[model samples]
Target: MALKNVIGIDHAVVMVKDLDKAAENYKRLGFTVSPRGTHSAHMGSGNYTIMFDPDYMELLGVLQPTEHNAPARAYLEKNGEGIERIAFTAVDSAEGAEEIRARGYPPVGPTDFERPVTMPDGTVSAAKFRTFQWPTAEAPGGVRIFACQHKTRETVWIPELMKHANGAKRLKQVLMVAPAPATEAAHLAKMIDRETRNEADGAVVVPSGGDRADFVFLTKDQLGKRYPGVSLAGLPERGGAGLVIVADVVAAEKALGAAGVKSAGGVVVPPADGNGTMLAFVKG
Candidate 1:
């Protein structure tokens, strides 16, 4: 009745030009990596791998060059290489997808898959996922939710791998940048039947309903200023697009430094000639 309560931050996807390279980058940052999988057979994209946490992170790369489905390619061409999609855990993938489609929005499918994941215990686990996409004019900045049903919930790798001595817990919030936060907020409110808060800086914070993942939408100016020279044309509309992973800003800054990943005033920008993947560790 109150719109399905959000579960939690499920996973964040980073679109990279090179999957192997990006995986290495995250591995150096302390994420326990998983075996690589090719989505080309199903999604028409390239190679991808999941970095585990209770919530998760995805590294997506364009493997084969083709003009058939150009959205992924266009994203890579325009943005260079950065965060591509953010997937939220939904209450019901089929029902959720149907609900959005019935709202006069573009259609999204109920897709599911089973993939192998390597746990820190050096064990292989087959994880199942069900996903849905919501179409909006905002594409990458749009609110897209993905509901994942793990074949086995007994072993969640996120809590173990992403744990920090500084008590970084789980992913609490994801900040998104968009051209029109107010309109986007209204659309999402109608789609999900939830209330959204409009901030003074023209950003919107959609609470994750207690323990679920919270989504924050910021303006282009805010994102540009934060990242300096990153482009935002290729992000998906109305789905999990642009994201800023929430953390203790000071601690995260120090961690990034230790990982040898340069930050532009505490922001990470994707390669200049690559797609724009921007992330900032802001104090919650």
Candidate 2:
């Protein structure tokens, strides 16, 4: 049984050393990056959001060392910037935490935090959120998992931010490279109380709720096979490899080309060109 309040993928958190530079890179890739927002003092982190319809992407950087952000800091030091975690949309984080406990996964928090959002009219407002995280060991294939409750969706998902220059729309799938794709997919299914299906190309698919993006797990060799001729030099050995976006391939290609960031065969973007996260643009 899937956790009742847990809906689907909310976003992917990309850890970057230089937040401003990362945002610029994403903009060059045709994303409409949001203005910087600083999290609550206790969290000691800042971020820029790349909004999509319901789903999005976050570029996170540590502003200062705090107990609450120790793990994130450690991850950056060890991983050298990459997709560090994935978030699920939760109806109620407190209830979600209870469900997680019932399912035997010890959750970290139902903690609340807020970030200020500056409206187009130059007024400041706040976007609040409540979140809970699964234990580190429970993370499948080294990618952490968490649940988020958006208390102020209006403030966060502003209409203007939803449009991308590359015509990117919503997140379609998250790709992970695991030693044992089936095992990892099975584990993820169990954690979320969902089911897994197999793909023809030896990848395991773990579907998310509603219209949200699914998670795809496969081996590095399989990934290379799937995107023939695409470089995989900086991809992690056993973690998040990239993301697939529902977008206009032509527009995406044009944007990337204009920025001098070559996309392999006009679809696959290697990790090196994607700020440590590979990107695949597909027709919606």
What TM-score, over all chains together, does every model reach?
0.72, 0.96
| Window of ten residues with lowest summed lDDT in model 2 | 257-266
State candidate 1's TM-score: 0.72
Q: Candidate 2: which stretches are off by over 4 Å?
A: 258-266
Q: What is candidate 2's local distance difference test score?
A: 0.89
Q: Per-residue alpha-carbon lDDT of model 1 for 59-127, expressed as tens digits?
A: 777667655335666756765566555566676777666666666655455677665556667887665
Candidate 2: lDDT of 259?
39
What tens digits encode model 2's per-residue C-alpha lDDT throughout 1-284? 77898999999999889999999999888899999999999999999999999799999999888998888888788777788999999999999999989988888999999999998788999999999999977878788999999999998899999999898899999999998999999988998888999999889999978889999999999988887767888877888888988888888888877433344344767788777788888887
Q: lDDT per prediction?
A: 0.55, 0.89
Candidate 1 residues lying further than 4 Å off, grouped into runs, are: 5-9, 44-54, 64-70, 105-107, 136-145, 154-160, 164-168, 224-242, 246-251, 258-275, 282-284
Question: Total backbone clashes of model 2?
Answer: 0
- For the record, the alpha-carbon RMSD of candidate 2 to the native fold, in angstroms, is 1.6
lDDT of 1 at 56: 59
